[model samples]
Target chain A: MSRIKACFSVLKESHKKALIPFITAGDPAPDLTVDLMHELVAAGADIIELGVPFSDPMADGPVIQRASERALAQGTNTDDVFNIVEEFRTKNDSTPVILMGYLNPIEVMGYQHFAEKAVKAGVDGLIIVDLPPEEADELTAVIKPLDLDHIFLISPTTHGVRLDKISEVASGFLYYVSLKGVTGSNQLDIGAVSEKLAEIRSKADLPVGVGFGIRDAQTAEAVGRVSDAVVVGSALVERIAEHAGNNEKMKKEISSFIGSLRTALDSI
Target chain B: MPEVMKNTNIDSLKSMPDKRGHFGNYGGRFVSETLMGPLEELEQAYKKYINDPDFIAEYEHDLKHFVGRPSPLYHAKRWSEELGGAQVYLKREDLNHTGAHKVNNTVGQALLAKRMGKRRVIAETGAGQHGVASATVAARYGMECVVYMGAEDIKRQAINVYRMKLLGATVVSVEAGSKTLKDALNEAMRDWVTNVDDTFYIIGTVAGPHPYPAMVRDFNAVVGREARQQCQEQAGRLPDLLVACVGGGSNAIGLFHPFLDDKDVALYGVEAAGDGIETGRHAAPLNAGKPGVLHGNRTYLMEDKYGQIIETHSISAGLDYPGVGPEHSWLKDVGRANYVSVTDVEALKAFHDLTRIEGIIPALESSHALAYTAKLAPEMDKDAIIITNLSGRGDKDIHTVAALEGITV
Candidate 1:
């Protein structure tokens, strides 16, 4: 089984919801990323979504966009992201690490080469924010055979044939964008999110992970009650931004935040 | 290389950007899943109304009365003589209402917005021509208008910014990467995704995901159709060459689409070579960059080896984008349309020469095409005809010109 599948199965068996924390891979500094990944695992994160910095992050709101800018300023690229994941795999190989970003960098690297390099570097899954399933076939064909879980995002806007289309090719988990807007914009209503989650579950067999407004332990707990996983991005990235240029402080902040969410999910 | 549409098969050549929006391997709906529903909705609306006679009549009626369509194909006799070779003709898009050919597409999209029952319209602009045009149409239609412009562009095109404001658009200054066209596009897409329910995104050019490229091209294709008819009526034959400047390539594609099957007429797309392509500071993606995805479509983009889009420079703010429309990429690959570059220096010279010789102040974007025409015209036979699209007027660029001359307006 893929690492992501294995990780989710383990969580399912334990009747526990997965806690996924996201951070830009090379944010603050490239050298700190591997350490940060290890720190995320230590803080009880079941899965880590590492952002691959792109110059234009259209889907992201201000917080994550700032993280991308900081990462890019540090000269981070796809190779650096892979290196970070490879280094993170040294001490811990069990926790699934999903690389998330836009599709251009991988396009420049070519689909086959990217999938091979990702697998070689111990990356478990991918979440290209801009690549919808209609345009995903070529990449999915190469990556899925290599046991790379090609995860997809399910938005509040997605329904009917479009929902079916995305569900058909998706693996690992379906990330449910909890709001209608870009990441880090607007407060998400739990009622609306759970309503959508129920709809998403009707079509896809994969676990549904809710994201895009879960900021605190309370919010994570609320989301956890209805989702197989809870994803917190902007809140963690905002914290990273607050502690940027101070690596130790940033790690501590991230660890504490993830630990709180982990505690909340466990309680749920 | 990807078995693009060969120059042969002119009949089917007009049906490009196939059903799934793949123009060869270039254009596709590469956007977030949140946007997929909206884009599919847009695609359906476009398909339904494009063939409907009611939509066609309404669009044409607005074009004739509001935008002043069939802008004259004027013979630049003095400039042609000064160039000393080809008899040059200008497809006078600069004379259109709102001072540019951009209004042609905006008017169509505004109409589409009305048909879809959208209460608000949004757009992204570079030189601010498209912004002003969108604002103008939105005001005419009584829809709420929001224009996303780069902070840098707002400074350069202050007059046009004021014009957009005067037309009642709320201009949002984007202070993001590069602070230019690409950044504004990113902001606009985000805005649309956020407010997909009540908003219609009027993409200024033939770029972006899927239906947008094809839809914008269709609306602006009137340029080629009119130019073709005008050239034959005035010059007594079809022009030997069709030339237009390319940024996101709406105007160029507009002029080139109708002429695609005209085997006798060659098409030239002039890209902005900022300092020069050799200096690696230019926005001439088809000339210097490689294929990559940006702003929802696969196209030739000015990106570093790592696939991060690099900043592009051009004196013409409209031309300072890293990527071209995907159809242009396909055309370049298939050897159908010729893509070339013009430096800022050359474009400035053309701007001055046209203003002096023809009493026509061409937009800096259009000046790039005129710059190439200045070179190519000198080499062609005097009897040869060249119809170049004056995409916009230079009134908005007067400040940039005066600053270059060290004279404060």
Candidate 2:
């Protein structure tokens, strides 16, 4: 079975929404990245999404942008991201890691090579924010050979036509953006989002991961009531960016944050 | 080159680069995979249009009638002796609408956008010259226009930002990293990703993925074509030297395009050395940068050890850049064109001298080119003619100059 399938099997058996926490690889400093990855997984993250910093990430609002800037300022690149993953895998290997970011770095690294590298680094999936289904085919063609899940994004603006298009290729989960705006925007429309989740479920068999505007415990639990995975990115990125230089403090804050998210999801 | 087009002014005998993109070693497309299809499509379209009898007529017709082409090749009578160089003549591209040579390319690309049935136009502007030019044509063509500007640029060039809005263009002040031209480019790329189906990205300079550098160069080459023909007709011989400022190097390439085949004419590219190149405070990418993939193409870039782009500084907002067009790389390697730079102090001196002597105020961007002429002209013979492109008039730069000099206008 694919790692995402195996991961979902755990979620199904436990009857708990997956607590998906994200942190930019090499934020604050490159050396501290691998340690932080271990703390989050141990703290109750069912899955981890590693952000590869691009010079411009439009889908991200201010918090994540600052996180990425810190990571980039510490001189992070594709090599650094993969190395961080490899280090995380040295001690703990079961937690599925999803490589996430824009497409430029992947394009620069070449699609086939990036796929092989990600698989080698023990990556389970990808969540490129910019790659639409039409463009996802570019990476999917290369990644599918490695049995990697190609997660896709469906937003509130995504209509009947685009949802159908996304359903055809979405694997592991469909990332339902709760808001139309960028990550860390104002508020999530619970009614509209659940309707979007229902709309996606009608056409596809994949589990839905709701993100973008999910911040606190209440918000996470509220979204987890409807979606299979509550993917919290900006808030976690904000936490990392805030405590970048202080590693122990950063790990404590991150683990506590993810633990609360996991509790909220379990309660839901 | 035949100069008539059945009431069309079609230049029938023109040439294109070979598959590897070599235009006599002065122009060629050296790029990566990100821009292959777009560049190929652009090359095919540009080749077809430049040779097409109808395209020539319409393009040249607009250049003459609409844009008021063959702009004055003025003899700088007072400035000539003041610089103590061979008498200098400036091909006044600043007289073109939108106040720079940029509109020449915008008009061409906008025409192509119209032909492609695209309704929305998106562009990235560094100093807002190209943004204003793009907005101007978008207004004329009745297309929905959106301009992306770095937040820093929007603050500095507020006048041009307002001009774009006045022309009914939506000005998006991008607040990404550095908030400069490169950031604006990143924002425009994001916008393109979102709306690529209906939008045409009007790149400001002869740089970007691939087709953009070549396409922008071809369109703006009107400056060189006009200057060369007019210089020969007026002086009865070609200039000893031709000069223009280099940012993404479009103006330099445009002015050098027609003169490259002229073996007698020496081409000079002038870059802005903001403080001094030695101080590591300069925008002279050709002189101080290394080759790298930046701004979607392979070219000379100002990057640090880990490939992070360094901030470039120059008094001239337009010429303040950390990279140059790739064709400039081919030119520098071939020894076809020589590039040099002038410090901000020298450019400002040239700026004041030109305003005082010739009653001509040049944009600080163009003053870098004039700085080269001011240095070289005095060393040449009286009969040795040096022609430099006065790329834009200096009205936009006057406040900047007054602020620096603490002089009341």
Candidate 3:
């Protein structure tokens, strides 16, 4: 099962929301991803969203974009992403893995093949940034039998009708894009977020996980108070960038940042 | 008046975008997986070497002594009389070495590229200005330079193509996409992807993933920093407003940075209105764009529902692009700056006005700033100062303008 679903189990028993730390799969260096994944989990990542590097990631911010540049620079593709996941499975079998990426590579790989490979490689969920909730029927049909959860995004711009569709379709959780703009923009209206959260909760049965712009413990706590989880990618990516070229420094820093974030989420 | 906006933490690490760029929604690392690692390395390298006294001192010395920065803040006495209203000041960025504001960033980025010990550099250009600047720096540093330009831009900007060749730069003509700036950028990125092991990609503006927007803005901020102090020393106060044309927004952003903290100073970025704003053929991203992703980062982009960029048109080849920097978006929302648009007709008229009155021909890109002044001057007081960035000299546009007028320059 997906670590995301397991997080809810931990949440139900501990009365604390989960902390999902996002990291681009190949950053600082491509060879470092699998090791970094283990470090993130040990550092308090209840769930790990491993981003597959794509040529274009429309939903990402600059930090993530830079990560993509590093991975793309090194020529890390979907096949490489699967290999990384397969390797991670050898060391960590209990943690659920989510392949968070755009749809181009999956489309290129063919849905039937991708679903099978992703499951065999130990991935439990998929979050294609560009796949709107309505258009996911084709992929869902292919993956439903495999029992892999399909995650859907719920933006502040998402209407009630769309929220209802996403809720029915999403099995893992609802990704709440905290703002209307793309990831890494500079402003957020708390009032707008609250209103959108109310809309999702009113219709969606799945846990609403808020992301985009949750960069610090203070901000993560603020978001954790409002939802079942707080997804922080840029913050973790920033730590990776902070210790570029030094594997030990990168891992240590990432763990420290995640530890702080875990404490913040649990406080809520 | 500046006291209200003065941030005392100007010299603190507290100003950084928290590794993730959470400037209260105005910034973050909205990039893809491939670039994240290298970007982090870049950030770390910048942190280690960028603030070194020697690195900063070398950069500053080159700016003042080599590039001849503190470029003149000239009083456009003649143009002011032509407008018959407000006093006008011209921030003469065109007087800088290499004949444009682009060299400022090129010099900074090139220096950083050298510090990283990268042996080769690649860049993208639209009007060839950035290509020429990059080529110049690569030659100075004895580095191999590859510049990508649209097949169309290579044709229109032949002189710059020749200059790059003379500088021993390989100019790659990109024909993919619309065969324009966007396509050229895509091609350049492809090169970076293939060669990131040994090559450094020098982006030309205040856009792209994190650190880049801030980094480019700092390099170009020399324009605003000098102009601000000069405007104060000479004019005895800050200008009532500041205006510049936007094209990848390097020149405008450079000129706008220092003034960002100046609350009373009204900043304006005039985008190319082209045929007209409503005609669906302009580059006025701030006026018409929705917040969609483009070119690896999220900013105001001219795109369709499917995220394919719509074709853009402008009198200036450089301004014929579909996005604005993220900083401009932040500024637009906070009301620190107002973005406006000017059509080809107004820009042409301003071009004519500057040529006839001041004997200075400006590039179509700079003409957008002139157009803003034409309208804004008539509305302000005679004593009120309005400084405009004459981003580049217009000699290269002589062929273009001559064709338009049915006369040879």
lDDT of 1: 0.92
> Chain A alone, TM-score for each of the models?
0.98, 0.97, 0.95
Candidate 1 residue runs with Cα over 4 Å from true position:
B1-11
- Candidate 2 lDDT by residue in tens digits, A137-179: 6568888878889888776556666578878987878787776
Instruction: Specify the highest-lDDT model's number.
Output: 1
Tens digits of per-residue lDDT for model 1 on B195-301?
99999999999999999999999999999999999988887899999899999999999999998867678889999999999999999999999999999999999
Candidate 2 overall lDDT versus native: 0.80
- C-alpha lDDT (0 to 100) for residue B202 of candidate 1: 99
Go through the candidates in order and give the C-alpha RMSD of each one to the true structure. Answer: 1.7, 7.5, 16.7
lDDT of 3 at A97: 80
Provide the TM-score for each candidate, comma-separated: 0.98, 0.73, 0.63
Cα lDDT of model 1 by residue, A203-238, tens digit: 988999998988999999999999999998999989
Q: Model 3 over residues B1-409: C-alpha lDDT tens digits?
A: 3442243333432243445543333444544333444566677877776678888888898888878988999899989987878899998988888888888998888888999999999999988888999999999889999999989999888999999999999999875546888778766765664456678888887776677777877889889889989998998999888999987688887888776666778889999999998999899989887655456555677865424357899979989988777777766665667899999999999998998898888888999999999999988888989999999988778888888989965
Colliding residue pairs in candidate 2: B5-B8, B5-B9, B85-B377, B85-B378
DockQ of each: 0.89, 0.11, 0.03
Model 3, span A1-268: residue lDDT tens: 4566776777868888878888887786778999999998898877789998765554565578778768867867777788899999899887778889876467556789989999888898998775654436879999989989998877654565655677888898888878644466546566677777888888977888888888788888888888888888887888898899888888888888899988888777
